[model samples]
Target: MNARFTRFALVAGTVAVTTLGPSVQAQALPACASNAICLWRFQDGTGELYTWRGGYVDLPSRFTDHVGSFRANRTGAFVDWASGKECHSVRKGDYASNYSGRFGSKIDAVGDNC
Candidate 1:
């Protein structure tokens, strides 16, 4: 693995299985084609200091309304449209829920805290 990929892996574990939505239309979008990367890092909101590496899905699932699980590191976590939160608080090696809707739905996107 290269440096970037290595770092990504350290924060976000290897993607075990990605589900392409039953609807073929959803697969045509970005992050669904290939080389989709999820990045995560700690932030001060104003500057950069205490940072944590996190993987970003950009576009996690190929299917809308689909719930998929991606591998995460010990300190890594996930937050999808389903979790109802915007931040990634998903726990690695455990079951995490997320909303695979269009752009993290506003109505039903409920992310759970870890």
Candidate 2:
């Protein structure tokens, strides 16, 4: 019985170590250029990456409902809704690990606020 308890403790300890370690912490966002905004198709900065520079622009059809993560390398990157409202703004050096459900797959445009 003691041996079984010890084995259980060991297993629990191993799981705690593996699941709560730094490796399981949030990852650094994927790279975006100095003056660009990058959106990813998966959270934690994984999957397809789409980059944008300056200008008022519509997200290409391929990415309209696909953006999941984002990093803003420029000072005033704005995520626009189809209703022509700015739903969220990402300042320079900022990152969003995930978007809200209402805006997540609904971002229709992107542009510089400055």
Q: Count of backbone clashes for each model?
A: 21, 0
CA lDDT of each candidate?
Answer: 0.31, 0.76
Instruction: Write model 2 residue lDDT over 1-114, tens digit each, in one string.
Output: 999999999999999989887764577786888888888877778887888888878887777867888888885545656666755666888887875354657787787762
Q: Quote the positional error of residue 12 for candidate 1 in Å.
A: 52
What TM-score does model 2 achieve against the real structure? 0.68
Cα displacement (angstroms), candidate 1, residue 38, comes to: 11
Task: Compute each candidate's TM-score over C-alphas.
Answer: 0.24, 0.68
Per-residue error at 14 for model 1, in Å?
A: 47
Q: Write the per-residue lDDT of candidate 1 for residues 1-44, one digit (tens) a residue.
A: 59998888765643422343344332211111122212211111
lDDT over C-alpha atoms for residue 75 of model 2: 59
